[model samples]
Each structure stands twice: as C-alpha cells, then as structure tokens.
Target: MTDFETLGAFYLGKRYDMPSRARRDDYVLYDAKDLTTHAVIIGMTGSGKTGLGVGLLEEALIDKVPVIAVDPKGDLGNLALRFPALGASDFRPWVDPQQATNAGMTADQFAAQQADLWKNGLAGWGQDGARIQRYHDAADITIYTPGSTAGRPLSLLKAFDAPPAAVRDDAEALQERVNATTTSLLALLGIDADPISSREHILVANLLHHAWREGRSLDLAGLIGGIQSPPFTTVGVMPLDTVFPPKDRMTLAMQLNNLLAAPGFQTWMQGEPLDTATLLYDPNGKPRGSVISIAHLNDAERMFFMTLLLSDILAWVRTQPGTGSLRAILYIDELFGYMPPVTNPPSKVLLLTLLKQARAFGLGVVLATQNPVDLDYRGLSNTGTWFIGRLQTERDKMRVMEGLEGVSGGQPFDKGAMEQTIAGLGKRVFLLHSVHEPAPITFETRWTLSYLAGPMTREQIRSVTALAPAPAPTAALASAPALSTAATGGGFASLDARAAVAPVLPPDVPQYFLPPTRDGALLYNPVVLGLADVSFANAKLGVTEQRRVILMSSVDDGPIALEWDAAERVELEPSALEQRPHDGAAFGALPPVATKARNY
Candidate 1:
C-alpha cells in the first residue's frame, strides 16, 4: 500500500469509533488538492483546535506548499518550537513551572518528563525525531507582527499601491477593492462610517477610486492632500464645496494628518511591505510558512491590515494562471469578527471575493474560529471541507449544523446523527466532513512535531525568529531595476545652483515637463524621453497589433550615458506633457552632454 504520509496526502491521524470510544488502525489521509475548494475549522476551546490547524499547516509545508497564516491569538508562533534533538534541554525554557509544582516535581524534572512524553506521543502516532527534522527542514517559519517590532514588522506603506492590470480591468473587483480600502482607512480613524450614508466614506472612496483608476499610488500624505483638495469638483452631480466645504475638508485632512504625525505611527511604515509573492516564497524561491501575528494590534488596526492583505492577495490571485491543484494556502486563525453575518466589514467583502474566485487560481483559504455565533455562514456556503471538533453548547452545534447543511448543496444530511457523533466526540477527536468524500468520518489528530508552548510573549517571539533572514529594505523592493552607477560614485554630480532656466534642447529632441501633483515647488531635471508607435503583422498567423510606448532615461556625462536599453517604460500620454514649466519652479542644472541631439 502507498504510504499515507507521502507528499500531497496530509496524514491527519487514524480513524476513531465514537460510540465504542476506540481508535482505529486505519490512517486518515487527506488529499491536499481537496483544499482547492477551501475549508473551515470550527471548534470550542480545549477541543484541540490549534493542534489540528497546526498539523494541517505542517503537512502542507512538508509537501512544499507555502502558507500565509494570519494569527490573531499568537498561538501559531509555536510553529517555531521545533526541536530535532527532542531533548530535555530543548523543553526547559518553555516549560510551565506552576504545572511542575502541581505535579510535585522540580522544573528540570518536569521538563525531562515533558520531553519523554513528547517522544512517547510521537511513537504512538508512528512519528519520531526524523519526521520532526523533515518538518523543520521543509520550510522556514517566520513570525511577522504588524504595527509592532516584537517580531518582524510588516509595513502598510505600500498597502495603498495601485492594483495590477488584472484587477483594474475588472470593474466589480476594482470597486470592491476601493470600497474595502476606503472603509478600512476610515475605520482606523475610529469612524464607523457607512459607505452609503457617510459623506466621509463616499469622499474618501471617490478620491481612492480616482487615483487608483489612473494607476497612481498614494501615501498618507498624498491621501490627506487629496482629501483637502479633491481632483474632481463635484460629488455625483453636486458641487464639491456644497457637498463638503473647504473648511470641513480641511478638518478631515487634519484628522488624517494627525494620524500620520503620531509618534508610534512610523512603525506602521517600517519593515517589509505587503507583497503576496514575497510572503509566500523566500528570496531563493523556496516555499515559506509566514505567520502574521496580530495579537498586538487593536480591533481597528487588525481590520485595516487584513483588508489590505486580502486586497493584495486578490490582486495577486488574478495575475496567476488558473489551476486545479493547490498553489498556496491562506489560513486565518480567528474569523469571527472579520466576517460577521448581519454587518459587512471591509474584510468581509474581500473574504467573500476570495472564497468565490480564489479556488479557480489554486489559492485555498482556511478559516478557523472558536466562536460559531458570529460567523457569516451564508458567505461561507460553498466551503468544500470542514473539520468539526467538540462544541461548547447546543447552540454552537446548531449553528455549525446549519452551516454544514448549507454547504451540503442539496445533498442528504442527518442532523441528528451528526449531532450524536459530535456529542460523542471527546477531546482531540473530530468529525471530518468533506464534500469530496461520500460521508463524514471521525478521526483523532496526530501528534504535532512542534511543541505547543501556548501564546508566546514578545521576548519569546524575538528569540524564536532571531535566526531568520533580515527583512529586505522597502526602497529596494519599491524601486525599478536600474543600471549600476558605481563608477560615478552612485550619486548625482554637484548641480549648478546659479542656473535658473530649463536647458534648451535641439528642435528634433522634444521636451515636455511633467505637471506637479503636490502643492510644493517642483524641480526639473533633464532626461532623454522617446515615444514610439510599434506594429507587428503576420499574414499567416493573421495577427496585427499596434502599441504606444514611452521610454525615459536620465542624461549623464558618464561614459555609458543615454542608453535606451536602460530606459524605463512609462505609462503616460504625450498630451499630459507641458510645453513650459510652472512659475517659481526651480530648475536642476542639465549635464553638458544633455544638449546634444546626437546623444538621444
């Protein structure tokens, strides 16, 4: 027989008899591909929920799958507690001394006992130190703490970046993203503004829509400026001033500006930006298990960060090729508040979008929660797999059953029978319900390779991730690839402060100045700009196409200057160019070689 623990098959555990309370010999191998349709884990406290979720992630990582887990409670950081030696010393630092005292043993003795218990638990589940090592070597686990430097900080600086062409081209997706972003931003400012009623919400939404539609990115500064002086003069046929006067607009701007100028707000702008590809893979292209711990963030911050992340993931998903096999997993540890039933939060919109569309692109979403009452079951009606663990109350069981029935999609479901099975479920026992399978089965979760040290402190988190790679500079990621200027000392030459006029170019070499978007004075620099209309025609293939491209390259007096090969392709129109610079704008001195038409 094929080994149940082989790649692509997650070895959850052996089957269990509920009525007889007997564990079966047959191992339950869950196919990783089944996750393409997504899954959910619903269990109450003390029901072994975290263990099962962590086990699933471990299996996925061992199979070379990348995971981006959002951990609100901080328990998932225990993924970093892998100790290949399985020694007492490895468990000493993390042992609970109170538990040791209760058990009538010294801390060292208790640690030794814990080590032995882990060894025996692994043996009982047919796992050993070798398998643990395999799990450790499979993927590098990193804990990321947003808005805090406890772990690797995750920056929201690039969160407002324009979506890729895929998302921008789809009107519904574009509007959905805009709505989520705007709502989340307002929420961070402690405004519970509704998209339909609140002028604040509508104006901010329109500002974002206008900028993003033009493929322009905005930081907090730019957004605040836009709020003060909107690009458009009207709001849905009404005059802008009448809708929101300049005084009111300035008030709104000040609020946002105060947030931007806050003492600790800079932390939100530091560290790595939210890039889905980087989060899913390491620099060497290996799969990674990235755990984003949000336990330190407030409710508003969590909603805002999650909304941005989901929006980015949605954009990333649209750029990926469609596939039936699972490409990656997005696991949200607690989904209660993010996706409530009656009220729609910014996170909910993106979550629903992902659940409906991400499956086609091989992105599986796993949502887990201990609170069943707050979930939006109607939104999760299509979830393909569910791991139902021991419930706390009859009400919780009823809510889960209703969700399960909705997921059944007209298939026969025996609520009473399932309830009995759930009632018979003991700790660590779960009912695995999957649409791909004919019927639900009961199974016990296998031993976890990593030690469950509970919610880790900031100090513990830092210790665990001390060896992980340092985060790359955000500037390096934001900037486009450019030629090395090492020979020129990697910086611009000293400028002529006396020069106040724009450099005159040959008639054949057209020059157009860019209009400034901000209120500050502008500075002009000479560059070699070219526009071309290229065409490709093939008679046999019956293909004919024409495209407009604009290339811009800096002019320098260096030996390898004016290289069109190193020019950046700019998405701009010739009409937007100005024939003259704005009044009072400063001019940067042109290089001596920039005036030559031959250089172009």
Candidate 2:
C-alpha cells in the first residue's frame, strides 16, 4: 500500500460503500507524482468528470506544480474564479433564479445555501479558508482564447525555428517541420495533408523546406509569396514547372491568401506567439496554471492551433534536462476527435507522441473524455492511472473495461464488480485505479477551491486575464538596473559597447538585446535573447544577487517583468520613449549606485 504521508499525497475523498446510506471517514488520498505515467478520466454527461478534473488541478496547484489545461468546452475557465471568503455573493451570479424558486428559495438564499454546502464540504475534506487561500496564493491562472480577443489572444505566426537537440539531423528536423506546418496550413485551407502524392502538399512542403534551409522564416504572407514564385527550379530532380506548374501553384496560394484576408480569420494573426516557457512558469520561476479555452473556435481553427501548440510543447520538452519526477502536466479536457480510435487527425499523432515519450521528460498528459467508446485505447496503453465515473450505455462501460484491461499490464480485473461500482456511482463520485495501488477504489471527488462557474463569455474571460499580474524578472537579472541605465552605462554599458563593436553574431546565437525603444526605455526583451545573455550580462556587470527588471511591450496594455524565456518578442514600434530627452552620461564613468545593484 502507498504511504499516505508521502509527498504529493492529497485527500481526494472518502471511500464509498455501496447499498448503504451511511458514509465512513476512510479518507482516500492520491499521490500527485503517480500522474507522471499519465492518467485518464472517463465518464458520461453529468457524471462529474469535469469535477474530478477540477479537483486534480486544484491538487496540482496546491502542490505548486504547473499545468496547461486545454478546455474545449470553456468550463475550465472557472479555475480563475476563487471564493476565498466562502461568501454567497460570489455564487449568486451563477445560480439560476427559476431553479432557486423551484427549490423553494430565493436566488440569494439558494446561493447562500450552495456556498455553505461547499464550505462545509471543504471543511470536512480538511480544506478550510486558510488552506484554500494558500492554494490561491500559489496558483497564477490565465485563461487564453486562441481565436478570440476576450482573453490573451495568441498569434500562430512564429517562425518554425530549429528543432530540439534530440532530433538527429537537419534533414529529419526539416521533415518534421514540413509535416506539422503542412498539416496546419491544410487544416486552415479546409484540406487534408497528403504529402505522399498530393500536388499541393508537394509544392507547399518543398517551399517550406527551401525557406527553412535558406534561414528565412515565412509567415502566412511570405508563404503565399513563395508559392506564387518557386524558390527552386526543381522539386526532387523533377522540374518544378513540370510537377506543379506555375498557374496551379498560384491557384493554391491564392486560396490560402483569401483565407488569411478573411475578417474572422484575422484573430489568428494577432497577439504574442505561444511560448511554453511562459505558459509553464512565471517570471519568479514559479510554476503557473494556464487554461487554454478553444470552445469558441471552429473545428478547423481548433485543429490548427492544437497542432502548433502540441508541436511547440514537444520542442520545449526536448530542451529540458531529463528528470524522473513530474515536472509539468498537459491536460486535454475533451479528447473526442483528437484521439478517436480510427480517425487520424493531426492532433492524434502528436497526442500519441506525448503519451509515449513525455513521461521520460516528466510531462504528464491527462486526457478526459465523456465518449469513451470512441477512444483508441491502444494508443493510450502508456496511461497508468484511470478515474472511471458513471457511463450511460453498456457499450461505453464495456469499452472502458476493455481499455482498463489493456492498460492493466496483466493485473487481474474484476469486470463484473467494476461494472456494478461504476453503474452505482453518484454525482462527484469516481473509481480511482492506478498501478501504484494494489486495487481500484471508489471515492467522491473533493470540492474545488475554484467556483464551478459555467462557461464564461469572451468579455468575462478578458476581465479575468486582465487582472493577472505581470511576469516577474528572473532571479539572475532581478537586481539589474532599470532598462534605461542598464543599457547605456549605469552598469551594462561596457558590455553593450563590446557587443556593438563585435562581429555580427551568428544566427545560432540565441541572445541579442534590442535597440533602445523610442521612449529611451531599454527593454530586456526575452524574445530577442536567450537566458545565457542575461547571465553573461549579469556577470559582466559584476552583480551577485537577484533583482527585478521591468520589460515593456507595445502590444501589451502594461509593462511586464522580464519573465526569463517566456516573454514574447514583438516588433519594436516607435514609442514615446524615443521622444524623451536623452542623458548626456558618457563611457568610463560608472555611478556609485551602479556598483551595488538594488533589489526591487
């Protein structure tokens, strides 16, 4: 039996004895680290799968672990709404007036009753106000809408950079990039990727490969241009003209160009590039909880963003140092079409890749689906944990049983008893199965610290994300002087001068500070440089301790702290900073304060 005192073990709920109206305080605890091998949560509609997912996320937040939850149904955005005071006023907006009247109470009364219920229930589970407050303080939640402006909008237009070091060769990396980009573009164009024999696929893939080899990054516009005019005369020894013909290539490119110029599609081009470093960690180097809601997007748009996001995450994973313990989680709430049994959606390939390899890098993937009958269990054999809730159909139950058996790895499964337990499960109840446990157990899910608000509107999402705190500067650069002084000579002047006089940096060098903004603010943009530059600059400036540095972005409403690798690089626009008066301080005369960097 797993020890309850182990780290990451949290109270999930008490065990449920069937056919009894009474309940015992046989508390059931789950070890969060067990999720390193991946987990599955299955149930029918109204079966509390969402509640179970929210509970697990709450546990992760309490443990200070980072999470990236893909919420296709928009319900997970509730992770942002916390009732720290446990007041009814916080619950009133979500309560239905008619439902309250039917229940013989006013809306306010019903809301108060619901609040009390949650409070008492949480108290029973040992999660009182103080403990819940700790969870709130530890978690920094952001709700992102990919194709909507309600939350932080995402731009899927970043350059397809070099592959991770794990990739064997440039040729192999190019092929992977070509495959991913082609699939995404095809999805955008409402076509399927058939790189083997399709003329359009052949033309686009070669164009991407040519641009990549030439160290040229192509956005949507550039891609159209490349297609209109072939970068190379030949494609795989056959003349490009003979294979795709100029007119055919223009026709294909124009189709994509029209899609790009569409008003509804413009949202895809706005906002910062999706950076996993920023998604997973805060400026203070703490783990963050990020909820990406794609419920409002169309099917094609969702697929496009999902493919790119997964590919980016895989690249990020490859950059990390290997670890045996759980480092982060990637949760997909509705895995209906992404990992269906027979259909080969682009996301399925990436999902399977993560399922098989992400564990080695300490990335746990939790997939939840109400439609269990359609899931491809063979691809999910790597999942070791299963949380089974009530299923509506016998077919779904049988499918879940078969999936359980497949993943059991020879462990004995009591199908008949398991079916009975599942069928009898009530709301907020589920069966917990794990290889780490001796046997599967049934338990109720604990109350979530976040209010279970229904799906939020774009305006509501925007309001929540707007209140998020700015990213903090990394510890190494924490005490660095303000961007203005740091760049000119208060401390880093010599280093800046040296860089200016040095030969042009190679494209492979990941760090380079941008020119001073028009307002004269020296923005330490992480998008332009790597962490090593910050470290090198800190050492050159002879700073020893951590200090905070503010990073200003024209695209954001306010300045954010330099969040290490998570900061998105945007085109430096002419700012009011350039119109400000310049200080006449010259080289070789360092201020006394520069010698001692002050901590923020």
List where candidate 2 sits over 4 angstroms from the true fold: 1-6, 19-22, 93-107, 168-174, 212-216, 470-600
Compose the digit string of candidate 2's lDDT tens values, residues 26-131: 7788877788899999988898899889878877877888999999998898888877888999888767677799999999999999899879977776677776
Residue 324's C-alpha lDDT in candidate 2? Answer: 83
Clash pairs detected, candidate 1: none
Index of the highest-lDDT prediction = 1
Tell me the deviation in Å of residue 573 in model 2. 33
Residue 201 displacement (Å), model 1: 1.2
